[model samples]
Target: MTPAAIIEPPAMMELHRVWKVYSVGPVKVPALSDVSFQVTKGEFVTLHGPSGAGKTTLLRLLYREEIPSEGEIQVLGLDLARARRGEVAALRRSIGVVFQDARLLPGRTVYENVAFVLRVLGTPRREITARVFEALRAVGLSARAQAYPAQLSQGEAQRAALARAIARKPLLLIADEPTGNLDEGMAAEVLDVIRDVWAGGTTVLVATHQKALARTLRRRTLTLQNGRLLKDEG
Candidate 1:
């Protein structure tokens, strides 16, 4: 007789009435206001908007780099606001972020940059080596593992950044303007890598001003204007 299959629970990320504001000498600057959304397991999403539209701010909130001024943000059941410091760190272990600038450590070798997060989390040296190499191979950067960021072209460095993001096998991946600096072909290549990553069951959210790319992907899109959600279409 065939055995019954086990059902894994769904992964859900939620943001509830999130508001982010900054104070500058008695002046309040709003970055995001009353934003609420959710992304389920394996979904690919895009946050689309013009500059200063709070797209980056929204991504940062998900990454827990910035706490919301009001409301709550949760990822995979962990509340960003109430989680302990260690808990937040632990949550981050299963999340990956690719910043707008690639942001690779300029002085480190490509492999080392990719391995840094694991080392910070005290992963074993052997495991770190294995994972880093695997990530590099996954991003098609294995041959340049020893190269420095300075030696890589913009597109190559972006790929390395993506490798670093995926090295930990994060459950959720967030990318901010990942292809902003690339040409049309390179942008397509970057999006292809992102799509492949999403296909592997990692939820992905890419924030970009590039409407053409967003439209091409045809993923659910959320737009922001004046710190408020303007449109959300799935």
Candidate 2:
């Protein structure tokens, strides 16, 4: 669809009475029921819940991979309902996402994996070189820049994923269970990388079933249960 004139959002995000329903055969199931919330710029937040509680669904909607069945979602000043293809693409470019498994390219070196995103965004070679190093340094993986994903340990792979996400210096980082596959020690390492990025002023939203991680981060937490918001604690 064609985009409308850009309208600056009043906040970093605004979701009013949002609902997301999916069709499985004939019956419809709700993934998010009347979820309404906003995230302020540069704020760190967590969405923690057990499986099937809509955390991932909510993140997908925010990133524009899917649209809510009902309600308004304005993120980073772009109205999802009205945002054109280019607008959505631009919006996504401003956000970074990480998954439970470090989705690094098996064949690419760590530095190339990080550089891919910048190349897609048309960044200059010199700037990409600087940013890639900066990101790798932040994740403590400078020495492994030439290592292939398959050669790295799980922890190193996750660190490389973090470096790739933060290389472009996106405004928002949405990590969906980034440490889900890690041991406590490895998870702690990943969390440290996230904390460093947050300290650098990137707004972050992490989804995890691990309650302790949320508490350890000492960030605001939003809990979802069976598609409904249950609790919000800081």
Candidate 3:
């Protein structure tokens, strides 16, 4: 099979009165209540909030990991609530997620880690090699391509995770607490890499609890509190 050479054309996301309620045995807890908003194609946005404020849940909804108990979610022009399994898989292929923990495969080399995505989608070996190196270079991890996850500093690990996400050249990139575990200098480095990705035209949504980070990025910020959108400061 050939590599995935598809270009991204500014992906837009929409949510209309979305609600997510989780039932824990006999008690039902609402994670997100009546949330609605839209992210225009190629726009960089941030979701800022304290823990338990529904930021992660909201993101998971976009990736369709958790379906809404009510309301509607449309991502990349598909209705998530009604999207079939195959559709969801295809959607995810075009979306990249950087979790707080980095989520790198411990045993896999940095290059292989990024290449895994392409290989899974049938990208040819030569294309995978070039794309993997390209992504590593983007995040300043080219020199450590052969390093294992355990050998990396927290910062390097995070950058490697970013490289893995970018290898696919996703249309939409979502990062949660990207710099949460890093120190001042390391956090700045990671943020810079993310900013570069946004500059390259991929729609980006970043979730972080750090107010200072949000202000520093200076992108549009959506504040979430108590499962509600408290503010939309663009």
Candidate 4:
């Protein structure tokens, strides 16, 4: 009898029994404990928790900003615990990250801020312009390309920041508290842009403390509390 081959789904991110502890002199502060989950390619996942619930820590682990104290993490097929510095750097280039703050260059125009990332990766000048505009257009910020960061409203600045993150057309997009600083209406606006990006086939993981926001996303939700995963609702 011929045996059939087992088909496994492609994984964009995986974490197995991961733990993270920070040492503060004589005390050890545990940031995450025994976390385990998997995010397959082209899936939209949400991480929801209150402040101090380790959502940020988990996202940091995904992009290799912080290594786990124990267990394993593989992102984009690279073992984060064992990958070399260069390998980690290369992996990060394929992953886009958005923080609570817009984090755009204050002195630069929105166009320049978005173009800067591509330029750092050695993208040609001609390509930079096109790519920047494409990303800005995706976030509905194309008309404000020449405006400085300070000239933008809170929502516009956040959109500009999103344009910068997606400029590289990353394989995965991770956002941590992306709408933390915005009002409810503004937050919805930013989240809609994120949803649009995910719909465009970029794997996405959003970390937020808002229950309403998580419900709005309507995707697989992983809930974290006090560094422990309490629920994974699909």
Candidate 5:
């Protein structure tokens, strides 16, 4: 018998009535409740809310790190809830993430750290070199490729993390409080790189509490409060 042709996926990322609940000692704690949103190609969006408002929970759901308790999440056309382990891994390859900390491997050089994901995903060595350098160049860290994480400045390390995320040319980029650890000026610089990534056609979703910075970016803002989506402003 002949095998069926594979169907291509539509939107890059999607969330439908998603909910996340944490069980602690017979009590249920809800982080996200019926959150529904979609991020298309080339859009820049920010999730703004105070701590414990389900911002991180929502981002985690999109990244497939945490499964929703009540609804479905489709990323790159893969149903995260129903996907096999290998399928989920493949789905994650198309998503990039930046956490509050740079989270670079301490001993590895900037280049190696940026190339780590590509190496794990079995990209060819030659292609890894080319892609790593290109990503570093995109984040303005090509000159510091050989520097260790400890040797670089905070901003430089964050930029290296950014380079790592974009090295694979992911369709969606999720950042959770990415600027939380940087100073105002350094945060702006990081935001500039994020804007560049969005301009390059990757959808961006940033979870941050910095209202001023969010306004400066002029992107759509999804405000969350008490585990609920309060406002979506464009």
Candidate 6:
């Protein structure tokens, strides 16, 4: 899709009465129940709740990593429940996801790790180099491009992961507990990067259990408890 096409979609993500349940020996465990929200382009939304509050499950549904047991989802204008496999893949290309773990490639250099995403999407080599550095610079990792994941500090590794995600210049960036494993100072640093990215016009949805972090963002926040949306405040 062209840049214009990507910009045309007003709602980057939407959920309508979505439910997700897991079956364990005739017992059904509801991970998410009747959750509904919309994240539009250029918005920074936060999803915060304690552990086991189904935060991860909700994000999985949005990214098409898992299917909801009931209800509908629209991501980048594609109906997730009905989208073909190729269509879903295409949708993911426009979305970026970060987890609590940096999840970097142990064998690859930081530069290569960031470039690998573009390579998979068939991005040109020239563009890949430019974008990789640009993303690294954005996350303040350009100087560590030659280092391996194991060689970096926890904060740096996460920043590298962030660089990889944003390198694609995705229309929507989803981070799940991005600062969960960081020290307070590091967490603040990482969040500042995220805020800067949002300032640059990329829509962001962050799922974290840290109430302080959510409050720091000062954006639209959705609270979940026992799989139910408890509050939505700005």
* Per-model TM-score on C-alpha atoms: 0.93, 0.94, 0.94, 0.97, 0.93, 0.95
Q: How well is each residue in 12-108 modelled by candidate 5, as lDDT tens digits? A: 6778888889999999999988888876667889999888999988888876778899988888888887899899887788888999999999989
Residue-level lDDT of model 1, residues 1-234, one tens digit each, is: 878998865656898999999899999999998999878888899999899999998888887888999998888899887899889888888898997689999999999999998898778888999999999888888999999999998888999999999999999999999999998887787888999999998999999888897798898998888789999897
Give me the overall lDDT of model 6. Answer: 0.92
Q: What is the C-alpha RMSD of each candidate to the true structure, in Å?
A: 3.7, 5.5, 6.4, 1.0, 4.6, 4.6
Clashing pairs in 2: none
lDDT of 4 by residue, 1-234 (tens): 878988889999889999999899999999999999999999999999999999999999888778899999999899887899889888988999999999999999999998998998777888999999999989888899999998999999999989988999999999998998999888989999999999899999999999888998899999999899999998
Encode model 6's per-residue lDDT on 53-92: one tens digit a residue: 9999999988899999999999888999899989998888
Tens digit of lDDT per residue, candidate 3, span 35-125? 9988889899999999999999999999998899999999999999788999999999889999888889998998888888789977888
What TM-score quantifies how close candidate 4 is to the native fold? 0.97
Model 5: pairs clashing at backbone N, Cα or C within 3 Å: none
Cα lDDT tens digits for candidate 2, 105-193: 88899999999989998889879999999999999999999999999989999999999898888899999999999999999999999
Clashing pairs in 3: none
Any runs in candidate 5 off by more than 4 Å, and if so which?
1-10
**Regions of model 3 farther than 4 Å from truth:** 1-11
Off by over 4 Å in 2: 1-10
Regions more than 4 Å wrong, model 6: 1-9
